[model samples]
Target: MKKLTNFTILSLFFFSGIMSSCKKDILETIPNDRVSSAIYWRTESDAIYGVNSVYSALDAVNLFVLDGVSDIGHTNTTFTVEFNIENGTYDASHSRIQTEWQNGFRGIFLANDVLANIDKITTTNTALLDRLKAETRVLRAYYYLKLTGLYGDVPLITNPITAAEGLSIARTSQADVYEFISTELAAASSALPASYPTAEKGRITKGAALALKARAHLWSGDFAQAAEAAKAVIDLNVYGLVDEYGKLFTYAMENSKEVVFDKQFLAGTLTHNSFAYMGPYSQRNSSSNFVPTKALADLYTMKNGKEITDPDAGFDPMQPYLNRDPRMRYTMYLDGDPLPSGILFKPVPGQGGADEVGKTQYNTSTGYSLKKYVVAEDLQTPGASGLNFILLRYAEVLLTYAEAKIELNQLDASVYDAINAIRTRPDVGLPELQAGLSQDELRKIVRRERTIELAFEGWRLFDIRRWKIGEQVMRGPVYGITYFENGNPVTIEVPSVTRVFDPAKHYIWPVPQKETALNPALGQNPGW
Candidate 1:
């Protein structure tokens, strides 16, 4: 996939004529290195570059570090955005809230800019032009999806707007925003190809549009529409799960067939610090800011697909890591587990272990570090991992289909097949769920499957909110691992931190304070 270079982004910003200056002389001056819209949109290359700039927003850390705010993941640092959100201490003035809002609108503005100017190019290839427009629409819908998902009702801006117009725009209802997203995706799906050439691998596709549509509907509680859209992607027969569950996150599997859509990154150019934030201190010599909580580890069922709380599950507190779901190891590094860098992860306090808690400020606070998406080579240099983050994959689509069916009380064979496909993947191979289960039973099973299958992929926060389980799961003392101390097993609660979630307001984040301040017409969320 071709990413937008820094220079290209600057060029696009200049061509859009969106940058403002306080001084009239500065506003009138043009840099020799920048091109105006009149000359920039005269070629086919310009159209492609303009659309590519929109993909840059997809790489925002706010999108990927979302699990830190949920019960499953914990953010250690007190100053970071995830910390504020996780602790319920964040307000409308939070930097991340503002950055997320601005980034989402920036993506929308870039996509709208391309849509408004792509026709200016003198291209004989009408098919390419249509595909580009479809791609831009998909990206625009994606931004709106993130915005409305986080802020409830956000302004739905589909066209490039002047500063004066942006100042007074009121918030659109979430329902209407989703309706527009669905309409755009439905139209884009038809114009997009099922697959792109290798050189254009990460470009948005028909499956991406349909899969996003399914997610949008699922989030909005439109089970039937969500199921229909997810099934459309499945029926396309263009995607399947990769053989190795763990390898799917590695750089080696960047081109996996399971990926419906992903954000592309180059090692030295556009990259993220995910490895440094999630890897063991011994592996990266950096603080593990985001680590898996004990609650997440306990969510995985035993090898027989029974919850540990079940009497027949044969779970031992002392031997918790043994006889559990294979994904538990694949997703996180437990005590005594060997890391990719060939270091034993022994986070026992006062044991002099490299990852031991309180050994150093850089050690894992949760006594466990994330194993998924941590490339050993990337550990050599923090924030330089080129591994593409899978935004939407086949597993999510399958699980979404199952959950939608379960929600609609349509417990059929296809639901079982969809869930079983992921459970029976060659590397996972957990026991297949039995048929003829009640809708409620299937719902529980599918929810658990989605949680374990997609852990740390930034969906848990939204899942809890949409399922209305925020009050049940979000408040409590967060815990870490169970380790033996002088022959006695002990579970450690993360110290000096309290978790709180008010069902009334925590379900949806507040609109950015700066935004509401600038445009009072954009009212605040109910409890914010």
Candidate 2:
């Protein structure tokens, strides 16, 4: 698959008239790079460039690091409010929360800009024009999805608006925003192709539109719509799980059949510091901002498909990391694990002949490092990781279908097949799910499958909130494993920090105070 280039992004700005100085008409303090509709959109290329800028609004770095706000991972630094969000200290003033709000609106504005002006381009190819419009609409709906998901009932700006007009628009209800997203995605999927050529691999596809539709519906608790959309993508038969479960996250096999949608990044031009944030600080000058917690590690069942709580499951506390799910090994770095860089990890660092966590402030607070999305090469090259942050994939589609079916009391052989496909993928092949389970039983199985399958991929945070399990998990002390002593692992559960999640307030993030100040009509969420 070909990577998106910075050259096109540069030309996008040029054609959009960012290079030309704009005369400030009544608008005071004109944005230096604001798009001027009167000066651009003269050709198909101009429309393409405008849409490309819309695509640029998504930041892979933000998507990945936001997982740190979830229970599976913890952020070490206080620079961002991720830790504060986790510990229940975050509010409307958090810069990260504000950035999430602003970035989504920025993308919405760019997408609307393209949609409002694409007809000005003289294109004989009606298909091209329709597809471009579909693409922009899909992207616009996506921005709305992000906005409403993060901040409930955000301002719905469907068209490019003047500065004065933007200041007065009130927040739209979440249901209305989701309704618009569903309508747009239905249109986009009809117009989009199932696949693109290698050079155009990152472009949105029919599968991506449906998959995102499934996601939007699932998030909104519309089980039937979510299941229908996900099953549609599955029936298309263009996507499947990668043979190696780990390869789904690596740069070598990017744009594989499993990847439905991803944010493309180039190694030298637009790389992320995921390794720096997620790797062990002892190796590769890692920042250790997002480290795995023992609570997450314990979520993976034993290879025999028995939970640690199961009486028959042979789980040893002394050697906690052994005989667990194969994905546990792939997704997290445990004590004494052999790293890809050819060194054995020491749990306590300096003591026990292991790498010391105290070597720098950028060390893991939980004594564990993230393995997914942080390849060995990323550690070797510092910031040269080009691994695309997968936004949607075939496994997620399958899981979404399974969850929706289970929730609707419609679990059947097809639901089993959907989950078993994910379980039986190569290298992580666990036992197939048995048939004739109760609806509640199947629901538990589906939820556990989602937790293990999508760990550290930025899904857990939303999953907990949607399932109404935030108070159950987030209002207690989080634990991590103790280091080795007397040549054996202590296996003690070291209390890290107690997290609080008020069921009423934490369920929805507060609308940024700045936003509410600018437009008082944009009322805050309850209990903010």
After TM-score superposition, what is the CA distance of residue 42 in candidate 2 from its true location, in Å? 1.7
Each model's C-alpha lDDT? 0.84, 0.79
Pairing residues by index, what is the TM-score of model 1?
0.95
Using all chains and alpha carbons, the TM-scores for the candidates as numbered come to 0.95, 0.93
In angstroms, how far off is 253's CA in candidate 2?
1.5
Clashing residue pairs in candidate 1 (N, C-alpha, C atoms within 3 angstroms): none
Candidate 2 accuracy as TM-score: 0.93
Worst 10 residues of 2 by lDDT: 349-358
After superposition, candidate 2 runs with Cα above 4 Å error? 6-8, 15-36, 78-80, 349-359, 482-496
lDDT of 1 by residue, 1-528 (tens): 554344345444655554333244646655455565535677777777777777777843454478877888888666676788888888999987888788889889888888988898887998999998999999999989988888899998888788899899998899999999999999999999999877778889999999999999999999999999999999999999998998888888886899999887767876778776677888757667788898889899998889999999999888898889899989988888877678789998867888898777667787888887787778678667777888899999999999999999988899999999999888887899888799889988988899889988878888998999988888877889888889988788888788889888998999999988899999999889
Candidate 2 scores a C-alpha RMSD against the true structure in Å of 3.1
